[model samples]
Every structure is written in structure tokens, then in C-alpha cells.
Target: MEPVKFNYEYSRKIRVGFIGCGAHAFRNVYPTFDYAPVDLVAVCDLNQERADIYKKRFGAEKAYTDYKEMLKREDLDAVFVVLNFDRNGHPLYPKIVPDILKAGIPAWIEKPVAYTAKEAEDLVELEEKTGQFVLVSNKRYFYPSFEKAKLILESDPFGKPVSVSGRYPLTLSPFQEELGKRTNLHWFLDICHPMSGIHYLMGEVKEMCFIEHQPSGNVQTLLSFKSGAVGNLELPSTQADTSPFERYEIIGNKQNVLIDNGMRLSYYKGSKGSGEYGKAPSYIGDDPTDGPVHWEPEFSLGQIYNKNLFLQGMVQSVNHFSNAVLNGRKIERATLKDSLHLTKIFEAYKNNRSGKWITIE
Candidate 1:
């Protein structure tokens, strides 16, 4: 059967059902429905009280304590699963995604899609068999600054990406043998952050080598992309609580771009001022406009740009998914293939030893 095509001008809103009513969904996901072309029909959660409260608050027509019952009764166009982790710190996406696909509806799942590579492969196979879409919500790829980076990298002005550097506050796990009983949950959860950025900027990784520091649990991974680009990822676990969480740099032949905290961006096309080492009166450039162009949202105004959903890329990603489902266009970012690549990175840390290079297929 052919996919449904929505009328861009006046088609009714696509009916969406949500599976998890957690704090994340309440703050980020449900709020986005107001801006997107979505009609939230139903919501499901393990806790009946929370489900009922979300249904009333978010305008969901029905709420159910059991997700299976909600899927059975509602003819939903799509489902969003923002569930928590299992006992092993594994995300519950692998267990729930298949059920959503079997119901003949597309789904958008929150990331760290799975704990292992095999689980991700299983989801990929299910997608192929059902011909249904499943998008992992990797919000960093959808951020405005990152989107601008994508354009710069793809455009002729930047030539080609030669190297990348990313900084994120993350904790590294112990060696695989010792990870069996470790209480460190950050390794499993935080791998997705840098992985999403790497996948978005550098494409799939061809090979990677990593080194971990024991005292601070800090890690640094060196990556080689399929495009022959090189990357360094640093996860510093001791960052200040009030400081921004991430920073990324993409270096090309004559151009370089930097994105700070997912919102601020700067592009350096070429060297601006040239002077002798000691003869230069000051390090300052010729004028205010001669060097790289910078972009950042103004925080003074009460606007969507200042909000976490918009600044962090959640809103755009959710909107894109809804539009694709409504308009019959294929999803461009956060595709199932992208999720598989991310899961591979997650598994690399889980199963492979530190300082070893793992190749992703």
C-alpha cells in the first residue's frame, strides 16, 4: 500500500499517540505538539495517575496504564516512546519498538536506542520487514547551529571536512571485565551525545581508537571517518555544573566552524589580518567585520530560541518527523540507519576494551 499523502494547505492534523509520560516528554515532547501539525489522541504510561494527569494536561483524548491496550484500541498514525532504562541500564526501546511497528504505525524513539549492537540490528531488520519508519531522537543533529554546520560542510565554501573536535561532559566506564558491577551509568547513557554529533558531521566512522583515564573517568577517542576525515572526542567528567555542556569544531581546507553549547556558531573562512610577529600593534583584527562571522540567539527576549526545546533541537526534530509522516516525504535525519550507527558506537564501549580500535560496519 502507498503511504498517505497530507494536504499541505488544509489537511487535518495527523493523530499521534505517546507511550511514555515521563518528565522529559512532559517538558519537551508534549509541548512541541502545539507548534507541529499533530493531534495527540492518546497517551500511555505504567503509572495510571501520571497517564491520567498527562491526558488532562496535554489534551490527549484517552489515557491508559498499559501501552499494549492503547496500541490495540487507538488507530494512531504514529507513536513516541520516551521510556526509561531497564535493570541493566539498557534502554527499553528494543523491547517496545517492534510492537509499535507491528501495529502498522511509524514510531519515534528516544536514544540510546539499545545497549548492544545485536539489539539495534534486530530493529533494523524489523523496519525492513514491516516497511515502517522508526526514527531515533538524536536532537543534536537537528540543532540550528549543527544544521548550519551541515550546510557549511556540504557547501563549496568549506571545501571538505578534514578534522573534527568535540567536547562533552561524560564519564567513562571501567574496563569491560570490571563494568559488570560498576555503578557508572553515564557511560551507557552519555555515549549517544558525541556519537550523534560525530554521525551528523563526519558520517559513519570507519575506525576508532580510545584511551581512558582512571582517576577522573575522562576519555578521549580518536576517530577516522569513511570520508577520510579525522576526529578527536573528549569527554571530561569534571566540568563545572553551571558551564555549557558541549562544544564542537569542524575544520576544512580554508574554512573552520565552531559550535558552542549547540546554540552559538562561528565560521572562520580564512585568515583575516596578517602582520609581523612583534611589529603588530595589537592582536585585534582590522575591523569588526573583517574576520569570521558569528551567530548566537539573544537571551533578553522571551522567545522560543531561549527555550531548551528549541535551543537543544528537540522541537525541530519532532516537527520534521511529524511533517514527514504527514507529507509522505522520507525522513532525512535520525533515520533508522543513523540509529544503527549510534548503537554500534554504544556497543563498542560495552564490549570492546579501552585503547582498542573497533570498526563499525
Candidate 2:
């Protein structure tokens, strides 16, 4: 589908309610309303003061301390759910999402989806039963650079992706022995960034073999995808603070694409060359299409792409969910499949017993 220009004044907006008036929403989710086609109808939070503040700040007509109360009182097309962690480092969505579905309201939620794969699977069952759609806010999958790379890989010349590699700067908390006291909770939160992009590009992981760094507990994992593609995830806990947080590359035969710092993308349009490698004159390519194509947003301009909404993918993601509801379309970008895949990977880390190979069923 072709991209539609956002115009709140000219276009109709979806009547939506928001839950969790917290810092994350204030910084990332709520600001996107300026560009998205959404009419903020109500705001809900545990704190009446925070809910009222958010209502006034974001143009919501009503404020409710109870989301169930908000759902009952307001006629909403969809709801945006953003909340902090629980005592177990698990997000509240696993419990709250079912309520939204039961009330016949669709949701756009943030990660991590749940503490375990079982919880995500249970949510999926509820989603299927309720027939209410959920669009997860996995922003990395919507990043402009990665989106372009995905298009390049899917088309000709690139063919099918055969292998993948991702580098993210994060640490695994020390392994805990207590059962169900998973020490990889923070890892689950951080892995969402890289896994969102990888799962969007590659299909799913069949299983993985992980290795660890002694002192820092940093890990490097080899992920085997069900699509027969292999991948490596490099988690560098000791990486310098000033260094870029992410680097990714995927190979498809001779064609490949590389993403740097989540901002720059280099797509190599590889094909059979005209001349021999050693016998060729200059290394410069005569064919423009066969060479590498690069893309990165220009920050100097006062453009929407320059802002965090577009830059960090918060805007496009919200726009995507809003478009699904407004256009009466099926939402596919952020689904329960991603939640399941990510949970399996998180579990794999928790099950990193001696760095041996582990199959994710």
C-alpha cells in the first residue's frame, strides 16, 4: 500500500483511550498523537492526579483511575497500553491485555510482552477467542533503515536471506538458581530492540547455541531460523558508553545489507560480475544498479523524519496501529507471533545451561 500523508484537521481520527500515564508514554508514545490520526478520548492510570494531568496534557476528554471504568464509560475504537514492570520484572500487559480484549477493545502495547512464553501463548489464546486485535509497539521493526533493507532483501538481486548477524550493547544479569525467578528479565526488555528487526526480516528461530563472557556475563548467541537461515546475536555488556548501540547485517547469496547505529543502511545489489576478479581493471563498478545503495535521514532539515517520532519509529508505529483501526484493515506489523518468538529467545537465555545447544519448541 502507498503511504498516506497525515492530516488530523482534514482526515477523520480514531476515538482512542490511553492507559498508563507514565514517563515512557510521555516521552515516546503520547507525542506521536501530533502526527497520527487519533482523537484522544480518555486517559486512565492508577493515580488520579497523573491521569488528569495526562488528560489535560494530551487533549483527552476524560480521566479515570481504573481502566475498566474508562472502558465502560467511553466508546473507544482502540486503546494504547503502556505500563512499568511488576515485582517480578514482568510487564502488566499479560494480565491487562485480556481485559481489553474481553471488553471488545483492540490494543497497541509496549514490550516486553510477558515474563515467559507460556504467558504470551495464553494471551494469544485470549486474543483468538475474543477476536480483538493487538498491535505491539516493537519500534525497531519499523525503523526507516531496517524497513528499506527489508524491501531490498525481498526483491530481486537480493533473493532470500540466508544468514543474519546482530550486535547489541546489553548485559545479562547474574544467573539466579531459584526456579521461576528468572534472572533474564532485563535481557528480555533489551532483546526486543534487535529481535524485533530480526524477526521482521527473518521468519523465526528454531533453536540456538549461546556462549558467555566470564565476568560481565555478556553473551553471543547463534540462532537457527526455521527458514533455514542462521543468525548470530552479539551482546556486548562492556561496550563503551560513547559507541553506537546497534549494528546488523544479513547475507543473501552474494547480496547483503548492513545497518549501522540504527540510522544508516547500505544495501549491496550483488549479481554476477562482467569480468574476472584478478583480471578486472579498476574496482569501480560500471553498472550503477549493481553497486551498493545507501540511505540515512538528514538531521539539518526541519522535517518529520528528523524528529524522534519518525527517527525512533514511535510515530510510524502509532500511525500504523491507528491506520489499521481507521482504515478497517488487518493489523500484521506487530502481532502475537513476535511476542512468542521473543519469549522463546528470552527463555533460551535463561536456559543457557553451559552454553549448550537448546531447541525452542
Candidate 3:
């Protein structure tokens, strides 16, 4: 594990201005600054009361109702945007981030970077013109479980990753035309959590086909990756509320890795089962090296790894942006390009029908 540096221990810090003081930011985004190298200079929201409260609660220097005013007054190294969606279920980032980029400030915007691929493409154009970058908060790229899985997949023991599967909870409208309406896109946009993870591990998807089971509206989407690996993503809407929310598996030549409930990880190495299939005396194998390796955090300890903020990748994601701003480190993940791929997948769903393959450009 890499050593973690607290905010005060860093030699340099990025002076950051925060936009939006909503419930999500209040709960997840702002608190990550405690573990990251950030100097909170200002916060902005349409509601002055919430902005002021967040400023005081998060130890920022100032608060403003207008982000443009905050941008004019503060010499910020970067900005964090975590706004809620509009009434139409469209994310507010695409409309808000161009101004921050125009101010020559790099931004870390929460996901659903846009409602459509065209909107994401517009942001890409602005990024090139202004020479300012935006890192979309696709936390799965930073999640430790996926990170370790990535390393294992690249190791010689795992061979080639041939296929992948994931299960997540999502509800879709029964009407085919409803898929394209911005009003119905909230759940689809939010489902990017698993989509981002699959894209990160499998690379770009070339084509996809989804079948929906209604009136429950459960869905299963089949994916064909550009790397030639195939994938299946299950969005079963009938799971119990108390059930484990997500699971993912990546299969190699003979071995496979599994992530259960987004926390526990098990890697099966295709070891021989005891002696013979039915003649084995014990199910446990004799060779220690061939056994499956497993890992999960111990809840008994008061460790950073045990915390949801770290486990879910919020701390590392924030740290990456801060380091990129302060140390001039290049962002290799969660780029606008990644957002483009995600949005393209969104478009695939929006424009295509069930059981028909849609090609992603």
C-alpha cells in the first residue's frame, strides 16, 4: 500500500474553490479534503445560506452565491463542481464547467458530465480550445478493489482477460421512447457507476445489445469490447433493499477474479480440485500456491482503508486532482475522454431498442 499523506503533511497544496453545496457534496466530496492536499479558498451555491454553512463547516475562507464572482475574486488553483441535476434530469456540469475552464482553472466535476454524447463532445472541444482539463469523477477507476484487480489481470499468472460480468441495481421505463427523453435519464445516468468500472477494466466498448424484462423493468446488457473481450451487465430491479448492491467478475484464460459487494475480492487460479473429481478425499487442495487468494477489510480496526470514503475512491480521486494541479502531474484516468465513452454508451441505450445491437463510435 502506498503511504497516505494527510492534508497538513503535504509540502504543497492546491487552493480550491468549490461550487455547489448540495447534500451529496456535503456528505461525500467536501469531507475528502481532510485527507487530501487542498486549501479551501471559497464555496459557491445559489443558496447563500447553504454556501455559508458549507464554508464554515469545511474551513473555507469565503462563500458566495455566484461562482463567477468567486472566480473573479479568488486565485484558485482548481475547482470542484458537485451540483444536482435539473428538473429534466440533466447534469448541471456541462453548463457550469466551461466558465471555470475559461477562467483557466482545471475542474473536477462529478459524473454524468452531460446528458448526451453531443454535450460531452462540446466539453471536449472547449477543453482543447482553452487548454484546461476536467477530470470527471468516475470513482471506480480509483476504487482499490478494481485497482488491485487491474494489477492481477496484468500479471503473468492471470493470462489474458477474455470476458467480464457485473451486477447492479437499476430501474428503466417500459416505454422504448422514454429511454431517449432527458426526463427519464436520471437512473440511466446514475447507472454509469458500474458502466465506468467495466469501461475502465475492459477498455472501450464497440457494440452492445440490451434486453429488458417488464413490467419490473430489469435489464441485461451484452457488451462487445474493442479489445475483443465480451461482457454482461445485469440490472436486476427486484433485489431486496438489504441485499449486496454490486458485484463484478473478470475471467482470464482459465483463472478468474471476483469482487463481491464492491468490497471483498477473490481470485481463483484454476487449481486442480484435490486429487480426482469424485475420488478426492478432501475439497481443500494440497498446494498452497494454487489456492484462491482473498481479501476484504477488517471492520474492527479504525483504519483509513475501512472507511467508505477511501474504499469508494473519493479520497484518492480528490488527491489525484490536487496533485495534478499542484505538482503538474498528468491525469491518466477519469479524463474527459473517459466521460465521452460513457456518454456514448448512454447514447447507445437512448437511440437503440431492446435486443438490437447498437454500435458505439
Q: Candidate 2 local accuracy as lDDT?
A: 0.83
TM-score of 1: 0.91
- Compared with the true structure, all predictions reach lDDT values of 0.83, 0.83, 0.87
Number of the top TM-score candidate: 3
lDDT of 3 by residue, 36-145 (tens): 88999999999999888998999999999999999999999999999988888888898899999999999999998998888899999999898888999998988899
Pairwise lDDT winner, candidates 2 and 3: 3
* Candidate 2 residue-wise lDDT, 229-302, digit = tens: 99999989899989998999999978889999999999876444457868876565777566887888888878
Model 2 stretches astray by more than 4 angstroms = 1-4, 177-184, 270-281
TM-score of each: 0.91, 0.93, 0.96
Off by over 4 Å in 1: 1-11, 176-187, 274-290
Predicted candidate 1 versus true structure: per-residue lDDT over 1-361, tens digit per residue:
0122322433567898999989988888888776677888999998999999999998999999888888999889899989888877778999999999988888988887887778888988998898888889888888888888888899987888999999998886676565543345545576787789878988999988888888787888999999999999988888898998889999997789999987889998655356787777655566746568899999899876687877778778887888888887668888888888887876676666687788987
